[model samples]
Target: MNRTNKLSVIGIAVFTGVAIMGDAMLSIVLPIYWSDMGLTAVWQVGVLLSINRFVRLPINPLVGFFYRHYSLRLGISIAMGLAIVSTFSYGIFSQFSILVMMRIVWGIAWSLLRLGGFLSIIQLTSKTDRGQFIGLYNGVWGIGSLIGMLVGGLLIAETSIRFITTLFGLIGCVTFPFVPFLTPSGKKEPTVQKTTTDQQKPLLALDQFVLTLSTSMVMGLLIFGVFSNTLSARIDQSYQDNWTFMSFAFTSTAIAGIIQAVRWGWAPFLAPFIGKYLDHTKHKQQALICFLLSLSALFALIGSINQISFVIVLLLLFQFVSTGFVTTTDTIASDLAEKGDSIKVITFHTIMVDTGAALGPLLAFGLLEYFPLRVVYLIASILLFVLAIGWISWLRKKQNDPFAFSVRK
Candidate 1:
């Protein structure tokens, strides 16, 4: 990458990191204050956590459409403005209804930020280094989430949730000046001449897009949606009264937050390696399958095992495997995006992500009312395992086709 592209990546990474910091802060803060915020039922937490994703689902396409016609930096600046408002509002309002409204607004902001970031990185990097760049973007920006979780936890323990939340909002506003450094949308470079075979397979491109979208949706369902909400609530419920380690000084929520931080912290160290491997391997499909299967197994183990130690280990494993799948799927999507269509392709992919994230917790929590936790996880495991198998079978069928689309390392 050139110095300009590097600068763009850094600027975008900072923007993404700050935006995610707000989200991570809420993930830690919201559950602890669910009842305190006038919410009576348990299901309400899932609803509140997921409603933003629901709002994001339909708005992503519009965000993409707008990117095609407008400046990316402008869109991102507007998004950052909304993020500041939404983060600040969380502290100002305790009412569930008002909180839900703020979440809706935050959803629109996230859609713009996410789409803008993906388009910017894709436009700035060459195909040869695309995976590494995307991985770097995710890895670097992910630190914001780690900081948010750690600092939010400490602040909640020392001062107040409202104070910490508002502080994060102000921190988000600090990214505004960096917006001008982002690469503009709809800017195109000269294309290399393609062989007749490469140019003849639009259907193959569509197929790859569908596969990548499906993988992204599953990632949303398992990683972003179900695990985050369910596990945090479980920890809070299990240990809220008097659970702790290290001489029983810390509350379970604090411990959980630390664990969550560690899980996120692993990404910056691991994503670059995963990206490089994907960029150099022909077995990308097999690697993805393995990651999915491993995640499915880990989910089942977590559900079946009740021991805290075992559960923690399983959760970490789940995080590791899920990270692999997420980076791989994103790299695939980036690979499949045709020139000048990054906005459209990324928007659709983001829609799938939002759809699954929106529905995962809502549906999982609803099922929890009727089923045991183990059964719920087992169902998720089975579903993902089936997807892995189906994907492998599809790969086998396409193995012999000369025009078949695959991510080449």
Candidate 2:
């Protein structure tokens, strides 16, 4: 990468970390603080946490359209401004209605940031280094989430949720100045051209695209949507009266945050290796099949096992597998875009992600109300295993096709 590209990546990564910190903090704090904030039902917690993702369902494609026609820097800066405002509101408001509204605003902000960050990586990095850069970008920005988890826990235990939330908002504000450092709108660099067939009908690549989107959706549903809420709820129930860490006396909220942190924070180290492997290998499909099968069994185990230690270990393994899927799908999307218009492919994939994330909590919590927690996870496991089989068949068929879409750069 050149100097300008490197700086753009760094700037965007820093901005992403700051932008996501508030949401990450809330993910840990919200379940613990739900009752105190007047929430009575488990489903309400899911609604509060997922409303942002639901809002993104429509907004992601719009943001992508805007990226096609408008100023990327200006759009991202405005989104940052909204993030700051929404974070500030979280500290000031206690009512459920008000909190939901702030979450909506934060959702719009997030859609912009997510799309902008993705575009920046795609536009700024050279084709050869795209996977490595995407991996690095995800790793770098993931640190923001990691810090949010740790700091949010400590603040809630020692100080106050209000203070920590507002502080995170202020931190988001600090990234406003770096918005100009992002790649300018409507800039495209010349690269090795795609074949006539590759350029003629991008939709012909739908088989690969659909598979990639399915993986992304399942990831959002399982990793971000279901596991985070369920784990926190489980911890809260299991340790109702004894809500403090052993000897150290840290609050259960802190412990929950640590657990969730471990789930997300390992990406920085793992993603680069996964990305490099995909970049250098042709058997990406086989790797993904193995990952999905492992995840299926692990999710089943997580549901059946009652021991907290076992559950934690399973969830951690789930995280590792989830990160592999994330890296693989993203790399695939990037490769597909290389053959045609990137914006359309990325927009469609992001919409699938947001849709799954929006539905995860609603579906998971609803299932929990009717069925045992084990059943919910078992259902997910079964569905994933089935999907894996279908994906394997699809890969076999595609491998035999004369003009199959290649994920290899």
Candidate 3:
């Protein structure tokens, strides 16, 4: 690899680590902060968590534009700077509105760093290693999440949320100087003249982009939105304690991250094989397989609610495998990106993921409020089935042309 490649990879990993750490810290500490401030409703907590992502739905595309037209590094720098300022202020301002505003600001910062880092990685590496590299990219965030939760847990056990937030803010600030190192220094390849087929008709490009994003949205909704949100709530109910719920959630999340990291190193070797088949095979069938297996996790969760130890263990196992597919599918979206708009493609992916994250709590809460827990799982399962049908139809249409990406250069 060239110097630029090495520096960009390292810098991207560091920033990813920081973002995950920040995320992990907020997961554990923010609930505590909310409770201490006399805010103690599941809906309120859900709002606190989900609103950050909801705001990102709009700002995420803008981050993509900045990355595409301007410097990814500059956008990342501004984002990190905002994160530092906003997180530090959390220590001094304890009001609900101020805290929500800080989270909104943090969401924008997260988009910049994450979207930029993903684009940077795509630029720095070749298509052959995309899965392994993307896995590595996500793995870095996993490690960051692990360390953040470990440290945040320790601090909250001994100290205060304010101190933890301040400490994390300092960590965010430290990453600013590293942003300059993330530039892609390699030259772009000389253009090859296009055949008629190479030049797609006008609306086709936009349609493909939207389809890729819709696939991303479905995947994100299942993984981040439904599973994460409902599972957390289920664990909380079983344990009847916030700390216990967080403990299990963080541990499981950390473990999932580690497994994903390890998979990153190995998955690329299989990527070529998978890509060949994935393009021709029934994606919807595979998607159905993914969902069916994922729903089995709800069984484990239901068992956990009944105080079955082995069932909770099974739940974590399901999470591990599900996340592996999630990571792999993410790389698939990268593969499907418009030729030159890799950043925008990935940004749309993130937005879809964030949208799922935002919707998880809302959907879960709405279901829990109006229906039984098992019924909620059934509803989610039905949605997954619908997504599978969509996937199948999409794959059948694109079977002859898997590398269907199209965009203006």
Candidate 4:
């Protein structure tokens, strides 16, 4: 990538990191501090947490439409503004209705930032290094997750919710001056252009998008949707909030926060390397299969293990598999988008990913109501194994036809 493109990618990643810290912190703080936030009902906590996602289900397509006509710079600016308002009010608002409205605003802000970020990468990066750049972008922005989970989760015990949310909101204000410098100013031109040979090749069957889009949804369902939402409870089941290290007592929530923080902390270095490998590898399908199978086994191992130390180690390894799952699956989506109408394809890809994420917790929680957590994880493992088997079939078919138009550029 050129210097300007590189700078833009880094700047937007930084901006997104800040924008997400407020949302990320809520995953850790909201349920525990609902009363502190003036919430009177327990069920209301789930509404507050999930309402943003429901709003995004309808808003992503609109944001995609917005990018087609408007500048990413403008979209990101508006998103940041909404994020600031919502995050700041998290500390100030006590009324449930007003809080829900702010959550809805945050939902819209997230859609803009997400689509805007991916659109920026699609605009700025060429095919040769697209994976690496997008991978790095994911890693850099994850710093906000690290901060949100680590600092915010740990600090809730020492400070007030209002203090934490307000502090994060103010930190977002510091990035206002840098927004325009990072995002592209003009509307997006078409990024997909088939080569002469590619033009001659028949397009991949099933709309050329179904495979990757479906895969993206499943991975998101497992990683962002299920694992993230249920991590604290999983730790609690294993450690019972009594695990200690080096004479320091740790609550399950604290342990869960630290574990998630550790993942994000390593993501900046780890995700980029994974992306760079995917960029260079010629056998991308094989790589995807390996990632899926690895995840399947890890899920099984996590479900069966009862030793807290071993489970923590297994969970950490599961994190590695998950990071690879998301990076690999998303890079496939980006690659596929580059082969067609970039915005429309990516918009659908985003929706599918959001769908998986949205459904994961509901499904997991509902199942948890009847089955053990191990049963839930094993079910996920079985789904992943089936996905891997399906991909193996796809690889064989692709080998039989050299000219079949696959999603990759």
Poorest 10 consecutive residues by lDDT, candidate 4: 400-409
- The candidate, 1 or 2, that scores higher on TM-score is 1
What lDDT does candidate 3 reach at residue 162? 76
TM-scores of the models, in the order given: 0.87, 0.86, 0.76, 0.94
Badly placed stretches (over 4 Å) of model 2 are 34-47, 94-96, 182-204, 233-246, 249-255, 401-409
How many residue pairs of model 3 clash at the backbone?
Answer: 0
lDDT of 1 by residue, 1-409 (tens): 7988877877887787887676777776667766656777777776777788888888998988788778777888888888888878877887778888888888998898888888787778776677777777888888988988778766876887678777888788776776875656453322333567657866555566677788888888877778776776555443535554777676555566667777678887788788878877777788888988998898888888766666777777777888788888888777666453666778878888888887778778888899876787898899789888867766754665544636333
Q: How does candidate 2 score on lDDT?
A: 0.76
> Considering every candidate listed, which one attains the maximal TM-score?
4
lDDT of each: 0.76, 0.76, 0.63, 0.85
Best by lDDT: 4
Ranking by lDDT: 4, 1, 2, 3
Which is better, 3 or 4, measured by TM-score? 4
Candidate 1 pairs with clashing backbones: none
Q: Model 4: per-residue lDDT, tens digit, 69-102? A: 8999999999999999999999998999999999
Q: How many residue pairs clash in model 4?
A: 0
Candidate 3: stretches off by over 4 Å = 1-7, 35-45, 185-195, 198-211, 236-307, 338-340, 400-409
Instruction: Find the number of clashing residue pairs for candidate 2.
Output: 0
Clashing pairs in 2: none
List CA RMSD, all candidates: 3.6, 3.7, 6.2, 2.5
